[model samples]
Target: MSDEQGFSPRERRASFTLAGIFGMRMLGLFMIMPVFALYGQDLIGFSPLWVGIVIGVYGLTQAILQIPVGWLSDRIGRKPVIYAGLALFALGSVVAALSDSVYGVAIGRVLQGSGAIAGAILALAADITREENRTKAMAIIGVCIGISFAIAMVLGPVLAAFIGLSGVFWTTALLALVGILMVRFMLPEQAHRGQIRDVTAAPELFGRLLKDRQLLRLDFGIMLLHLTLTAVFVAFPLTLLDAGLVAEHHWWLYLPTLLLSFVLIVPFLILGARRNMNKQLFQASILVMMAALLLMAAGQGQLWLLALAMMLYFTAFNFMEASLPAFLSMLAPAGAKGTAMGIYSTSQFFGAFLGGVLGGLLYQQLGGGGVFVLVAVCMAFWFWLATGMTNVSKVRSHILSIGVNIENKDQREQLLQRLMALPGVHEALIIPEEGAAYLKVDGNIFELDQARRLINL
Candidate 1:
């Protein structure tokens, strides 16, 4: 058995496959940011409000479809749904590229968002990796997204300037086409275990996941996080335009800022890991994000002040985006991890939609400052929730499958008691319906050989 918590060697390779799949998909989405707004404004029926609508339309579709798509992936297969989503995304990109009207662009964005590849990709990742090593797989995918976003933000404008907005859409279409090739050629067509959800299991699955307080909190956190992000970007580009900078040159601000934020992100993550300061680090980042929004609201028209505000904003954004999933892994129940993640991701996309609509309204009425104010209020609430979170101590755990002579409650309890008495055993949870046990233990005390012996492996 591997010492790593979330993946075995074969699973690690699969993890990279899913991560690359997700990265390429997100790159298509990110490539639109720098060019869409300015070029879109020139189109018929396009206004700042419509630009925000176009930007968020995909998320609205994505939010609505994520859970169903995930549930579908669990049933039919991962690759099939993934292929369908990518094809839709590419088709939508082509539609948007050919459209001369903003309404058409919005329609295309809705179609693009219908792809909703994230849920399927994540479910596949979970299916491939061992439970102990699942977090690492998710982390790898998350980091790939962050890197892709940072790079794409810089490249979007440069590419847009060279080829124009339609060209950007065509480029996104080409990327999606390439992603389809990768899926068809490179990825293994493994029939993922646990991909299907029984209709009979649906009631219990939803009920248990909904009642989970820890999962709820993480879900809320994700919602708020993405809400703040979408809301900020709704106004951020406009703020740049208002400050005497054209859209193409907006990269001048984003490129260096993203690089610096990336540099800062590594250190905080290292500190959080080494010092067991994950809780503290997580809370601090939320607080910092809140402060940045407030600072943006207060800075208003001053160019230098806005620059500083953005520095804090991206710094906090990068840190929290990386850390939140790690936090969820620590908090999520083992048996329901996939469901928990699915719910969390769904909430994130929903928040993106809400943020866009709300931010657009606020910007239309009160301009950039209003957008900042709205985000600040949202962050303030997040800060309040975060401060109450219990600090968690990391423990080594593995999901173990074993055949047990589970005759009755007493027999199962006795077996659990016996397992608890073993060296290094920390916590043991076994779900009969799921046919698995998750054990937390002292890594050094429980050798794989010993564990196998204890479980009659």
Candidate 2:
């Protein structure tokens, strides 16, 4: 049996394979961000508005389907949902690949969004790993995604330079196919076990989680983060052009900025973690985000200044992108991570869609500088919200199977009491039908074996 000592072999397989799947899928999506408008100009009925729609329509469908699809996965199965989602993504890529009109590509983008597998993919990652090591599994996937996004931003224009827009779509289609193959062959077979509440969304819990001010603030922050990201991608290229940097050489800027951001963020993250400065680090990152935006606005037509601002922007972006979910997970009630994440994902996509709209509108009306300044306003609001939020540091969640021996309500109550009485346990929820106990614990002091013994499993 797998214990907390390390990742079992299956966990290793699941983590790397799932990370590959997510990385490929994200690479496909992000590859278009930096080059879409430039390439869309070649299509029939090309216009700035159409480019924005095509870029963001994917988010629209994704936001609508994320929660529902996650809910569906609980009833059906993870593999099936993942397989179906990949197929839709591939089909969308094909549709876009064959399109000569911007409208057709917009349709393809919408189809791409229909493949909402994030919740399922995350749930699967959680299911395969031991609770103690689950974050490491997730971190693997997160690293893959961050790397993919950076590569895609740098690679997209280079690919378009050689292959054109249609070819990029075909490449994305191939990527989706690769993901499908990995799911079919590379993924480990999940063992039959009780429903994992910590990792799986509970529809019954949505009403309460939705009303939580703390969680809502996090959701709004992610939404703003993505909204600014999409908006920046939409508008910043024009900023580069106005600064005398040609389109092709833009990758030079992105490559260095992204690489430097990744390198610089490590020390910051280490300091944040080691000093137990979650809230401070988080709020400071938000401030950096706002500063980056304002700097972009002020640096109009200044290439060197804009490049510096981008470095700051991405450093904070990368940090917040990874840290927000960790904070949410820490703050989420035992058994509620999945639902919180589901809602968080929905907000993220919706923000993307909104960003596209806003980017297009602002660029047309007030130009790239205006987009950055206005987005900075939103970031300022998020920073304020972050200041008011509470941080749950050094806490980890665990879902333990309490074997089906309880015969009555009194026995269940007694069991829950004992689990709660254990030192360093902050939250406990026992679901008898599921034969599981969900717990949030102070990792420095909590003993998993003690809980295991108390559960008599």
Candidate 3:
């Protein structure tokens, strides 16, 4: 992605620093997911439903506050909002760590979610990176997220075994403080209004984005994915326990399953993407995932079989986590990607919230096996929707900074049409206010020089 000059040193600093910050925050959050179901039962007002509530409560607050916090960053600046969020996060961690009751823990989680800073972090990434290298920067942040999630899976168990859940919460609070230090000392102070349409949500654009069928499909897919994952975890930890895996040794199973799953995921993603078998592999993963869930349910007491099924489920889950965003960026209207993602993320969080409620309910009424069966049935419906999604041919985003804002509405519209007419530019949007043109390009056929000439960049 380098020209005569590659990503500026400052841009490199921004991406990596933000990624580290994001990962630290996510690591703390995810570490809770694996152990909560088991240890939470020790709380004063313990119940399966409250267990699920504590697990999923953060999602509800995160979904509600994420966009609004992003909007706040546009007014008060990124680091300020980021600092405030981290403070809130630390406070919540302390509250949870001190709480003996499940209700108190849930309240603490809600406070933690209120410190939603993902949008602000992304918006800051956009502020610092060049338009052309934006995707690379975003990809770095995304890769960090996946890595954090994997590490947390292992670390959560190890930490829980040594330190009680309160100790884990205290550790998260420390992580939040680390994030604040990184922001204050490591991150550069260069945030502006950051009116980046493709990296920050636009309230006006929400309506059209919501109505787009393709975008909705991706949204639905992400929502269901999170829902099933949260729901499964509600009972999965207990299932392993019932099957003779102690809470302390749970990491033994997770460590191997996660590692083995990673071994297959890269090749699977590469082969699928390269062969244009994305949709086929996507649907196949869904079916395999459904089967895996059922197998786990039926094979509960059989540890080895349960492990195999868990591995299969993770392979599918990891693949989709990578694929869905790519598909969304490909499907999103150029310049509207940010808003689309906001809605998509909200759907994801809301799904997690729903998962907790549903998982707890199903587990209470029908037990662990029923949770798997019912979730599989939900996935069957997801598969039907997947079959109808707009076939996602691979593409990537590029933006040309014309460096001169064109305020004329008619002229901007004409320029948009002209850019769209360019060969291999699958989608184009001209933002007159920003003096840039956002485009989704098929690199194989797109000629950069031709578009550069048209924009006189």
| Candidate No. with top TM-score | 3
Count of backbone collisions within predicted model 1: 8
Q: Write model 2 residue lDDT over 1-457, tens digit each, in one string.
A: 5556788888899899999999999898889888887777879987666766777778999999998887677778789999999999999999999999998998899889999998788878977887668878988998999899999989998898789899999999999999999998999888434346665667899999999999999999989999898888888887898899877778989999999999988988888788888788889998998999999999999999999999999999999988888889888998888788888989999999988888877887888899999999999889888888886588888888777746678988999899999999999988877777889999899999999888884
Could you give the C-alpha RMSD of every candidate to the true structure, in order shown?
A: 3.4, 1.8, 1.7
Sequence-dependent TM-score of model 1: 0.88
- What TM-score does candidate 2 reach? 0.96
Compared with the true structure, what per-residue lDDT tens digits does model 1 show for residues 160-267? 888988888898898888888877887766776544221112334777888877667778888888777777777887777777778878888888777888888789
Which segments of model 3 are wrong by more than 4 Å?
Answer: 1-5, 405-414
Query: In candidate 1, where is summed lDDT lowest over 10 consecutive residues?
Result: 194-203
Best by lDDT: 3
lDDT (10s digit) by residue, model 3, range 79-178: 8999999999999999999999998898888888889999999999988887667888899999999899899888998999899899999999999999
Tell me how candidate 1 scores on lDDT: 0.75
